[model samples]
Target chain A: MHIDAIQTPAVLIDMDRAEANLAMAQDLANDLGLGLRPHVKTHKLPGLARRQVALGAVGVTCQKLGEAEAMADGGLADIFLPYNILGAAKLDRLAALHGRVRLSVTADSAETVAGYAARFGPEAPLTVLVECDTGMGRCGVQSPEAALSLARQIDAAEGLHFGGLMTYPPLGHGPETNDWLTRAKALLEDAGLASEVISTGGTPDLLRAGQIPVATEYRPGTYVYSDRMQVAWGHGTLQDCAMTVLATVVSRPTPDRAVLDAGSKALAADTCGAPGFGHLPAYPDAVVTGLSEEHGVVDLSACTRKPEIGERLRIVPNHACVVSNLFDRVHLMRGDEVEEIAQVTSRGALT
Target chain B: MHIDAIQTPAVLIDMDRAEANLAMAQDLANDLGLGLRPHVKTHKLPGLARRQVALGAVGVTCQKLGEAEAMADGGLADIFLPYNILGAAKLDRLAALHGRVRLSVTADSAETVAGYAARFGPEAPLTVLVECDTGMGRCGVQSPEAALSLARQIDAAEGLHFGGLMTYPPLGHGPETNDWLTRAKALLEDAGLASEVISTGGTPDLLRAGQIPVATEYRPGTYVYSDRMQVAWGHGTLQDCAMTVLATVVSRPTPDRAVLDAGSKALAADTCGAPGFGHLPAYPDAVVTGLSEEHGVVDLSACTRKPEIGERLRIVPNHACVVSNLFDRVHLMRGDEVEEIAQVTSRGALT
Candidate 1:
């Protein structure tokens, strides 16, 4: 099917642009002599993950076990889940996934490590990365000492391999992040632990991955499909964005206001300091003033040529990762024609 | 399955609370001698829509043809789609639906009316409501005169039936809205056109619906599952909220910070003048400070009690309608027991 033949409020991925993005990220990682591990959360399609692997990425990073299971089912060998896993239901699934592939997970607390130790044995070990809070304050232990304490617990556990350390760096602060990681690695080495890998992730600071003193690998998710937030952070221009929501102007209620079929449902509501929900590439000055459930109210007052009713527009969402989770399937577009329709297999896999 | 057995980041509906909320709205409409048309966009489940019909709803209001089709498939006869129907693809589906159900749609302009007229014939006419801008500036004709002009166009059209006027009124403006509708109905009567159903909708103003002198019917969507937005609007207290997002505490990165498994993907990013994304009943003073794709960072600084890892918490989302569209299925809970797991059958059916 052609791109226009598809329905409105649909997810359209420019395959060529996506492939170019993949090549660029891999090239940067190669130039830095660091292993590239792209996060599958950005584009949860296994086809894309396989392409990333085929294009020299060592493995993939997943935030949830359901995502890891989906990728493993698609024959992905190495997978890293960088979130604290708790509860018997999740540990059971994690153990099953661990048996299928070379699995690694992150932990910042002793409780999470103990849960993993109870699930797996020494013969069949799971790599555990001590997640550190360099600066981003969302997850991970507070300091290098806290990270070493978690690493010690993982090393002392029965069925866990103390892999290394990982941190999701704050944007535009590569040097300070590197110093933190280096200090943590030095502490781990002094404690007679081998820091096999040091994983750092931030798409905005991806190109500066080489500068991180002891980092052996980098994981970038939004680098696969740069969005409005990424562009706002100066990661790349709008030209680097691969994913765009194909929406049609459904209601022209007034001369300055046009409503598109795509709203919070299609484009998602993750506004990373962007003025509106998404950026309309066709109308650069038109602001997505408001969003209801299925109506994107666009202010066309700034546009010299406003879009008419039924006219299609491509919208770059505020955050690409959240947008991917909104749709069940996405149209892989090769120019104006659709190459394939891939199901977002890991969508809503927040278990 | 029990309520605790369901996975994290799941949508849970208190069946008793839901039934009570439904009865309250139905009783209000009955006392006012107004036909109640509950908008199915909130629940999107046929079972719930059936319950609404069983209680007192004259029909169900839908925002899209796809939703109306889903309701029609579930044995719902009267389905009002208050959206501008355009394009041959949608009109074809609309024509088929018009034959199967007692279909009515809204028109804000001649273009939308022409599309409906071109699809249907006089033998099987489609009801077209002149959507008037009674001040909610989303999708409606600017004034009552424009509404009257569109009504004349619908009356002249061969395949259309001028049903009446409809307005999604701005909150707390019942008096002004009634005056606008009264004048529009008076002008229609002066022009010798029958205004059959003067429909108005707004959950915040649903209780004041009877005060709208010319309104014969009322449509209320979010009242079935009152959300944080409704509570903020002073429509009802938090106790009246039926739907809540059941999420698990995943991580405690700091003394004042905890993360839940639900984020934008689960709880949604729609902030209806609320400071946070959703309201936590357990931690009323706590704020959902930030949200990533799969993690909601809760600031527990103001709380005396903080949620522990693996502990489940119920969250009242900002907008119930948008939250309903985020999940594939919702858990219907009767106290602590899971009565049913109903599929959101009309989910992502956006054409």
Candidate 2:
């Protein structure tokens, strides 16, 4: 597509690359006997989620109820909201989704489960998976006893159904992970209750998927849009990444530094440990030194070649998931041509 | 409006507070005898820009052609883009805008000015201002000689008019600001030219604005939407700040921290050296320790109160300008009541 025809600071998706990445994950899941639940939160594009289902994903996973509702609206029959639902507002929305689609949600505390129960009503029991703090200390119960306590509360409650256990484990490799999962499973098994499903995964930990043998399902989001952080962290190559931010050089006021029109506004600033604003595939060495509201400063002094002002450049954002959440829609491109403008159905589904 | 009706991650602008802030800034500018050309890059809200104009602004300052178009659509008559315009496409867009409004743009290099000349034609000469680097090393020419050289290029060009001196003088309050503007004016006046319009201002340096005698205009974006940084850096108080992100606690897996539904998507990750994803109005001491794509972790272990799940909170974004540029529309409200959903008229005017 001619850069001038498209608006500046837009998200661009390569259909071929996206499809290939989707297929790769499906084949791996099928071969490994793992249920593929593609996290729709990464793309927030219903079309991408539909493609994942078509490629053999068991269900779509979302981080918020609003996102799950959007996916359901997009015709996904099965969805899992892997986020804690707290208020009556979201619980009401979740109840509505549960009635429409085959829905399951997560909860870490008794208060949250009780709150959901209060909203879902006594007769219409809502499915809930107890969350366990595997290695990520951000959320979930620390011990299996704590998990069972919440699970048992749900099991006894009138308006709640125990669906199993879930955890967003730390992205790592080797016996440390193997040991942790094994112990977690042992603890659950000793509780005299078999977990119908144990959900575990993230794009960063895809390499170590083999270690989590007890996990029946994997929820990987960034695999579909592998980015600078993924490539730098040794997760995926640049070509394997499907999504990119198409930006133009708005100002190069000096010889050493140039600024792009896409700043954190387009990028969303979830660096995820990457070194720059976004990667310039054509010029890999350039460093995005600073970002103002509408301006991104790229220090190209280190590069062998100079990039001119008004030049269109593809930036693989530091965090692909956050980048996907930035735009309302992204152009689905096939090579150098525009194919479609797929609405990001879950763009602002933060609730 | 019921907090539930106000969408999660939606920006709520307090009209009364916003009007007061606008009045204060315009009053400050009037008292100082400086032309108040309020920066449109901050609000990107036409209504706010009009209110500034009504408060006695010389003209509105736009950062992009699309922004200028939006302002013109809002019935604004004049705009100033204080940055280099590159490429035939962008220059053409600017030329088109000149028909609807009086447009004045900035250029730092000779090549960019030449492109402007090529695009605007003879009868539609583009109004030009040379952007200079005083202390903020982000953009503009380095020395007074360099500014003079670029100014001469604009003067020599067929479709370009030299429009005096401009500099986004470094962010802090100091004597260097006056020193640089004075020296730059001397250099221009020595070359048989007078610096008629001197434009220089940033929110941090607003208190010291009177120091620069040559500066005839002041452009400050963040004064309208003061944020956490502004409050921390002594720019404004929380009460004086007019905009905030209203989010819900979506996750409270641990007693120490809880994650909110509004992550980088709502906050825009514009952390300007302040702590936390956002500050809870009721709990300012809380720290936002970490943020995922859809989850913001608020640490309240040390604070006197813990944010329960489903609790609604207001966040003063790390940086306000970037947050303003994220959405298609911003909901204007007055004390828990949403009034209108105003389109960001210039949401993605990157080029």
Candidate 3:
């Protein structure tokens, strides 16, 4: 089937662009002498994870245990979950998954480490990384002393092995994050703990991963399918975006406004600090001013030429990761032809 | 299984509260002498649509053709889709669905009427309502004259019947919307065209449906599962909210901050013009400050108590409809016990 034959409000992945993006990121990581562990949250396709692994990615990064399970079922060998996994249900799943593949997870608090310690045994220990808050302030230990304290807890736990340090640093704060990690590494070394794998990630500062000299692995999720946010942050151009929402101009309600079949459900509601919900590559001047659930209201007042009703258009959404999760399957396009329709193996694996 | 056994980041539908909300809305429409056609976009569960129909709903309203198809497949006899049916693919699907169920759609332009006229035939004439703008500034005919003009076009079409007028009016403008529909109905009467079904909808102003005396049918989507937005609009209270996102407190990175396992992928990014992304009924003073793809950050500075790690909490999202679209299945809870795990059949039916 051709790309045009597919229904509107469908997700289209340009395989050519996606392959090029994957190759570029891999090349950058190889040149910097770092392990590239691509986060699978962007595409959530095991086939793409395999492609990254084929291109020499160390493993894959997953945000949720369900996502990690899906990747493992798809034959992904090494998986790293940089999240604080809690509760008995998820811990049981984690232990079950641990028997199948090489699994490692992160913890920022002693309570999370205790849960892991109680779940696993020394027979096949789980690798636990200490998540440091290197200025991101979302999750992770507050200071180097706290990082050392958590590392010591993991080291002492019978069923857990202290893997290393991990941090999701803020964009453009490489030097500061580097200094913070340096302090944490020094503190860990002083306590007779080896910080073997220092991991840091964020697509905006992915190419500059080497700035943080203590980092051994770089985890970048959005680089697999760079979005409007990546483009806006100067990480790439619009041409580099691999995913685009195929939509139709359903209604031209007014002279200045045209509505598309896609809305927040299709393009998603994550804005890249931009003026519109998405970027229409064909009509760059057109701004998607508003979005209801199923109607993307495009402001065509600024454009000299506007789309008519029934005309199909492709939109590069604000965030690619969230958009991937919104759909069940995505069309892999080779130019205008449909190469394949791949299921998003972990589309709604929120747990 | 009990409600506590369900995993975190799960959508929980309180069936007790939902049945009460459905009954209240149906009773309101009955008292007002209006046909209650509840929109199924909130739950997107055919079972709920059946429940609404059992409680005296005239039919069900759907935003997309796929949703109407899902409802129809689940034995919903009457389905009203208040959206423009465009393109060859959708028109074909719409025609196929129309053959199985009583399907009516709305159109604002002659172009849409032409599409319906091309596909539908006199044997199974489709009902096409003229969608009026009525100050909403979304998809609709601009003026009452435009509504009449479109209605005349539908009446003139060989394969379509002029149903009436439909408007998704702005909230708190009941009298103005009533006057606009009154003029349009009068114009249709002057042209010897009877306005059979004057349909108007919006949950925010649903209780004021009687204020628009010209409306013969009232469509309320979110009232089935009232949300933070509904409560914020003074439509209902937090107790009336039937759906809540069950999440786990995964991290407490600071003294005044905590993080949940649910984020945009689970709870969604929509806000009710309120400060937080959601409302925690158990902790009314806590505010959801921010959300990443997999983490909902909470600001607990104003609260006297804070949630500990590994704790479970139920959050009422800002918008119920979008939250329904985010999950694949929802847990039906009768107070503290789990009733059933219902599938969100049309969760991502954007097309």
Q: For residues B1-351, what per-residue lDDT tens digits would candidate 2 score against the true structure? A: 654587577788888888888888888898999999999887888898988898899999987777788899998998988867776666667778888888888877777787887777668777888888888877777888988888888888887788888888766734686787788778888886676688887886776787776789999888888777777777877787788888777667767777787777677665655676666777878888777766777888878778777778888787777777766678787767777888787664455
Over B1-351, each residue of candidate 3 has an lDDT whose tens digit, in order, gives 898798989999898999889889999999999999999988899998998999899999999988998999899999999999888989999989988998899998889999999998999899999998898888999998898788888998889998999999999999999999999999889999999999999999998888999999999999988999998998989999999999999999999999999988988888776788999988899999899999999999999988999999999999998888888889999889989998998766567
Candidate closest to the true structure, highest DockQ: 3
Per-residue lDDT of model 1, residues A1-351, tens digit only:
987688887888898889999999999999888999999999899999999999999999998888899999988999999988888889999999988998899988887888899988989998999988888878889999898898999999889999999999888778898999889889989999989999999898876777785888899999898999998888889998999998988778899999888877778777766798888999999999888777889998989999988788999998888888878888899999999999887675567
Task: Give the lowest summed-lDDT range of ten residues in model 1 chain B.
Answer: B342-351
Q: Poorest 10 consecutive residues of model 2 chain B by lDDT?
A: B342-351
Q: Give the TM-score of candidate 2.
A: 0.93
- Give the clash total for candidate 1: 0
TM-score of chain A of 2: 0.94
For each candidate, the DockQ is 0.67, 0.52, 0.80
lDDT tens digits, residue span B1-351, model 1: 988688888899998989989999999999999999999989999889989999989999998777899999998989999888888888999989988988899988788898888888989889999988888778888887888899999999999999999998888889999999888888888999889999998789887777796799999999999999998987888999999999888789898999888888778877877788889999999999877778888999999998887789999999888778878889999999999989886676666
Model 3, CA-based lDDT: 0.91
Top-down DockQ ranking = 3, 1, 2
Each candidate: how many clashes?
Answer: 0, 2, 0
Which is the leading candidate under TM-score?
3
Model 3 chain B lowest lDDT segment of ten? B342-351
Off by over 4 Å in 1: none
What are the clashing pairs of model 2?
A1-A336, B276-B288
